[model samples]
Target chain A: MNTAALHKNESTKPAPATVNQYTFTPRVDIRETENGYNLEVEMPGVDKDGIDVNLEDGVLTILGRVQPDNQDGFEKAYAEYEVGNYERQFQISEIIDEEQIEASVKNGILTLELPKHAAAKPKRIEVKVG
Target chain B: MYSLERHLFNQLSGLNSLINGLPGGTTFAAPEGRSRRDEFPRLNIWKNDNAVVLTAEVPGVDPADIDLNITSDKIGISGELPSRNRAEGEAYQRLERSSGKFQRQVDLPFRIDTEKVSAECRNGVLKVRLQRAEADKPRKIAVKAA
Candidate 1:
């Protein structure tokens, strides 16, 4: 997408552009186990329907969106922070088993499990007498 | 690691700004790197005429783990980001998220009604709402034509 043209079309300042969508990068922690690798991503305020995870061409992408929570009957006098969409991408190596990947989200954190392929697993061959 | 590189970059940028302050014949301009959100548990506090609202972004924290306290003029928030249990042979490749105890206290200018305060945790975000005390609310007076 040509985001520069979109930015130019909405060059007006002080007023937030309706098409302006910020991409927040969530913090990630990756761990490798004997069977596979685990990925933990922090994405707060995202509902179950607001998250999308896709894998294509050895690339895994995580996208999330959240609605701004505003209390009822309270007029905002000032705002010091903003909540926006989240996006992150990672490359899956050949050793990973693409067919057995799993993911779950809880308390704003997304955990992914990528198991390793059988061919990639280490093996020890026994010697036989000839 | 990315964190170490960003830390050194920030330190160099700080020194560069300090160097610019000295009387110099030449000023060096370094290209700025992409800004990173290294600070965990960012907070936002705002107030209206009737109440004050405070929100914090704290992902990976459970609702039962959070401890919140609110007085007439002060609010305190404390919580811990639990670390995930690993298997026997698990090894970390990249670790950036913070895991530990965090606490923050904010002082409000106007007194709030302790009985009316409310707090909720959803989607890893904490929102605290405090209503202004009856005597602390602004009063509107009408002037009659004399």
Candidate 2:
């Protein structure tokens, strides 16, 4: 499949206004289908209410906020990963139908379906016998 | 064996604090011989006077697929992450999310009351609450007048 229609933006810029905490780039998986592209983002600990998806100027942005765990008197015993907000961006080309983009979140995974424009879909050419 | 695990956990917490205090929010490298990949599902542990809470991020995994084991001083988590089904003409553009089997074991500082442990998975995060064994908790000693 030709993947020129969508590409991930590698460099990440800090969000304008955020609290004193780290912002992580969530891992993602992208798949190309005959209809469009499917995007799966991993944002553990983030609920549906805490996610924000926006598309502007041909760029799609995803942000996920995680609530801090309540540790009033508990001491840190062991740690490996840090808890923080998640952010990532992608560049969308004109081949995708911007208006038809769909998103859903479940089990901390966000799935985005980017349907291609009708004109961009590959059409089967039938051969005629004389 | 328990003491050694406790010592290791203390060192890890110390390193975590050091990373949190660094300037410009610099992230620290993983400890020697233990790359991040080896630790399939990363865990964070918190302990109070009588209880310990452990959390891990295991996205895209079904709760039923998660298997947990609890001993007096250790907890084990193992699970299978089912792969997404693909139809004909579907191909991957960028694949980063991991799938398949994963297993991780965490050692605790105190003996746990295995019967009292409870765990729940919410939004891809698994949280396990463990209570210290009744006999292991420190008890107040009242001095009698001599």
- lDDT of the candidates, in the order given: 0.66, 0.72
Residue A30, candidate 2: Cα error in Å is 0.1
Kindly provide the TM-score of model 2 when superposed on the true structure, using C-alpha atoms: 0.81
Residue-level lDDT of model 1, residues B1-146, one tens digit each, is 33443344345434221011111101122213312223446667778788898887788888898888788998888888896676776665556678889887768768999999888888888888888999998888999999
Candidate DockQ values, in order, are 0.24, 0.28
**What lDDT, from 0 to 1, does candidate 2 have?**
0.72
Worst 10 residues of 1 chain A by lDDT: A2-11
lDDT of 2 at B65: 90
| Best candidate, TM-score | 2
lDDT of 1 at B16: 20
Shift of residue B46 alpha carbon in model 2, Å: 0.6
